[model samples]
Target: MRPPNTPPARAAATATADDTEFRTLLDRLSDKATEDYYNPFTTFDWPATIPTDELWMSPELLSFHGTELMDELSPARLQALSRWESVNFYSLNVHGIRELLIEVTRRVHTPGFELPSEFFHHFIGEENDHMWFFATFCLKYAGKIYPDKSVKLPGAPRDPDIENFLVFARILIFEQVVDHYNVRMAADRRLHPTVRHLNHLHHQDESRHIAFGCRLVHLLWNRLLERDPDDVALRELRDYLGRYLTTSIESFYNPAVYRDAGLPDGFALRRRLLTHPARQAAHAKVLHKTTGFLNRIGVFDARH
Candidate 1:
């Protein structure tokens, strides 16, 4: 097992060798993205109406899944909840893609990023298409995209490497979590064809994006380890990332979604569902792959 504070032995190799490996991976991923590209606007045959009776998302992926709250809802209310939750999920994608685009655009072609700038072009383009499709789905089906209510933490002075790592790490976390849903929904026969198709397309794109993100995060994190070996910094990074993972999970339990679904005391329900043992287990399952990757890369302690 890798130590929590130390970069993986492979990641700690010579910077020159790491750079070469990363560039090679970038080239491969870029090529894959190009080959896999599809016009989001024309890819889907948007239906005139999605039946309200059918689920828009996989039931197991819902925020309240496995909880008493889920069992309490009538079949009609359950379907209604799934509909709003599905819209909320896409709305999150729109906001998350916008944020990542700004961050990636800020660094693309800028100093210290000359090598990856080319791949960033493909990344930015794909993310924009993702945002467009997600927003369109919400508007056409739900009549409106849910407003983003996430609060941005104030920026503090930090080393350039730390800033870069945090930016990309957040992006990686978001993509990984979203991809978890995308994969399940895309394959779930219970969902509408349009829902499955949209998720299928997003999942295909996210596979490449997640691959690129993992390599870049490994590179950036290793750079941080080399420059700052202090245990304090390692602990702080671990704690911050743990909190971020929790926040990402919490976002799925939106009060707005609960209220839209006709559930009373939306805030209270969110709190209750988040703490339920069954839901907690579900959260762990959802985050299993991502947390494992972070732990392996030494961004999170095994105990985390």
Candidate 2:
């Protein structure tokens, strides 16, 4: 076996003498960023007015944890369920993109990262415009944008060091988790035309976001390993990541959704979905992607 100091040949093949050459990893990453940069600002045509609709969600992809409850609703109520879910989903994206871009701005400026910083600058620009469209749609059609929640997950407070690596990891994790559902909506040709269009656009952008995010987190983790090799620290990071997944999936069945559905008790239903087996499985799909990425980065219990 080769010594630990020795580079794997495939990696060595493309590495520079100064730093290990990563073959296509950096190039592909930069390319994706470039494409996002070029059209990110102009990717979608903003409709002057959003059409009125009861459901903004694609039914095929609804988590279905408590969807049978839908059978109890009148036609109008059922339509409201769809609208609430779709608007809630996109509104969260708008909020997330705003916060994440701010983080991206700070990271793009760290020492010795000049070469790679350009992509992040462009990435943030795209996200800024993306936040605009999503927020605009909600304002124009929904009459009000969804507000951010004060919910806190179980974890250490975000310190600067953690924010540098951990926040990006958190953002990356939650976004892919979103794709676990949004992908279904994007492909469901049966959804309302406007809903379909919204999902289709967001899905396209998020595809690139997840790609860069996975690679970026892995890159950040490697840097962390060089500084501290503690297994506990690594595990804590993974646990924090797991908490976000749990909390985020739970956010799907919000009080607003429950109240809009005309359910008398909102918090109780939210609790049930968080605990229900079927819903748990759907939630698991989101966590699994993040866990897998952590495993690939040598940060998790990989025995599986």
Candidate 3:
């Protein structure tokens, strides 16, 4: 565990004895990481064979799940869709982890991160291993990891405080969103063995990341509040989080998954699924815990 206030000076300002809330939480989190250390490379037994006839993701968790489209698909077709959907899910993990690596790597050596650097060291290594196995599954079974072509949002705030706020907030959002899937699929015995193992391994590591993120976000929100009391930065952050969460949920509806499933008009299906009220409800459910936590912490508001 990183000491209460590590070197590099700036970290002490935020995490020294003065900030008991953050220091205590970070200390607890660091201990948990150390005690729960895992080597992702050797954790799961990569199956000798992936079952083609079995479902890869729970039927209830599918993008078109609970919709008319789900009913229209034959059982075999649904099974096929699940296989591709699992690939899409893993592919998203790969891409998300890649972005996280870039963010954490740049910050680990920066001034404010000195205290968190120790945990970030473990975080980066675990995430890299995650990306490797996820991409391995995608490439082995699905032939390729799907590319993210969604248009990137612009106008990120230039203020360093707000920027820092956005960084951890976004990290929290991404982890919690994917964790909704990981927690569910990890426990569902009906899915393929490979899929279950993948989700289980990810869930174990992410439990630590999510705990660290929740505390870090709370601490940063406090700093953001003290540093920018006018609520100007808060409003910008709320807006970004709203859009970011929505986009994170919608990423599950990849057109490539549809195309690979032999479904017609992949783009059309993505459009329909994303716009459906049922799908919107499901998205809300997926985001319920995360959004609620953010709102409770005053980092997010529905009216913002």
lDDT (CA) for every model shown?
Answer: 0.87, 0.65, 0.82
Steric clash count of candidate 3: 0
**TM-scores across all candidates?**
0.92, 0.81, 0.91
Estimate, for each residue in 1-304, the C-alpha lDDT of model 1 and write its tens digit: 3346654433333342447888899889999998999999889899999999889988998988887778898999999999999999999999999999999999887655667789999999999999999999999999999998876654422756678888899999999999999999999999999999999999999999999999888888877877766887666666677778888888898999989899999999988988999998998988998899998998887788
The TM-score of predicted model 3 comes to 0.91
After aligning candidate 2 to the native by TM-score, how far in Å is the CA of 165 from where it should be? 2.1
RMSD of 3: 3.7
* lDDT (tens digit, per residue) of candidate 2 on 23-140: 2555666677666444534656656754434456766445443455545667676666676666777678787887788777766755534445656765676677677777876777
lDDT of 2: 0.65
Global fold similarity of model 1 (TM-score): 0.92
Report the number of the highest-TM-score candidate: 1
Model 2: per-residue Cα lDDT at residue 290: 76
What does candidate 3's lDDT look like per residue over 173-247, in tens digits?
Answer: 889888889999999999877888888888988988998888778777776676545667566667777888878
Give the candidate number with the greatest lDDT: 1
Cα RMSDs of all predictions? 5.2, 5.3, 3.7
Candidate 2, pairs of clashing residues? 15-21, 55-82, 55-83, 56-82, 56-83
Model 1, residue 165: displacement in angstroms?
Answer: 0.6
- Point out the higher-scoring one by lDDT: 2 or 3: 3
